[model samples]
Target: MGGNKVAIVTGGARGIGRGCALALAEKGLDIAIVDMLEPEMARTVGEITALGRVARWYVADVADHARAAVVVGQVAADFGRIDVLVNNAGRGNPKGILEITEEEFDRTIAVNLKSCFNFIQPVVPVMRAGGGGRIVSMSSLNAHSGGVTSAVSKFSYAAAKAGIIGLTRALAKELGPEIAINCVCPGVIETELGNSLTKARGPELMKGIALGRLGTPRDVAGLVAFLATVEPNFITGQDFIIDGFQWVV
Candidate 1:
């Protein structure tokens, strides 16, 4: 494994993932992107290279633990180390529990929640060997209030996001004193996912955004990059909300 300065960002092909990868690259870290889309992944990699940072891409569905393991190993081999892991790969599920089927729920949980563990497990040893590391996973404000702001996700999505918070808290204690891990819950981000939800919910979702507008991928990405790149944060198991004071629970 490599030393603290390399990063692996999942779902780095587009949107928030891309933004996170770029920001971290700009922060002077070599990046490895794990994503399913080759074209988009290439775009992000190209941007990283232009910024003079080493970039690698792996086309893998992180929801599959087996695939994630193999990919993580490849990343370790390619980068010669692993420092930060940004779990930015997730699916936007707008289906209510009643509207979603069993398969959909299982898949959503795997993609949004379980995938974090899938990579977290294998990457832990790599980071430990390199001394220590930082990890940041993506959550959502919807997890706090059942997505009432958008009404796009009712049960399944909310449950998965809530699960992310639980997972982050539990893991933080176990991995502490060496590795730092945290979660980010952003509200109504201005990304493809947000735009689609906006199409269904209209622009009214901006009603009470404390910042006077929806959050951007870059907005959330900045927070993720900070947690991953900035050291001695002395922070873990915390949920950092990027939403403009939508809810405080």
Candidate 2:
């Protein structure tokens, strides 16, 4: 709401995270971007600063809880308060069950799910201290509909994402009137990750969507921005699906 609210977006260097940072900055929120890629993170920081908002970049792996805590502390020290947190950093594993190594499975779980815990845990106190805050985590349509890959791979991703939704609901209830938490389940988007997956799966994958087109990062970013604002204060503990009605038969 206020023009001066501060927000942190994980993986803010590129793709959906970049889109979200710019969108929020346009709405007048000072941004603190966290990403592992130092150069790209700096680029995003530059873009946010150019928009006349305070933008700081931190290079840290969101999956590392201790490191994430330190990064969050630094953000609070610099910004004075954090009104929003976007857990947008994530990864995908497209390999079939037999092909996916334990290392790959662990990495996906760490990046896609555990990062939420790392980011949210530290920020919760800051938010409560500030009176309230909004948190949005990225889920995926594959979580519900399941992936086309082998059972083990699909199960792992789906389980992690489903865990995100569960976390959102439980945390929303725990925080209650003080903070709002929600999850966004995106369909195939036109990000580098999305493109690669689509190419790997071939054109047949597109046939499932009635809209006949993949989503854009902007499409998902718009929803994230809306949730961050005061207008969505009444909304919490919900999972909003942003696919092109692909699940519709």
Going through the candidates in the order shown, the clash numbers are: 3, 0
Quote model 1's TM-score: 0.95
Candidate with the greatest lDDT versus the true structure: 2
Error of 2 at 115 (Å): 0.8
Worst lDDT run of 10 residues, candidate 1, spans 201-210
Estimate, for each residue in 23-85, the C-alpha lDDT of model 1 and write its tens digit. Answer: 999999999999999999998899999999999899999899999999999989887889899
Candidate 1: regions farther than 4 A off: 1-4, 148-151, 247-249
lDDT at position 107, candidate 1: 88
The worst-scoring run of ten residues by lDDT in candidate 2 lies at 147-156
TM-score of each: 0.95, 0.92
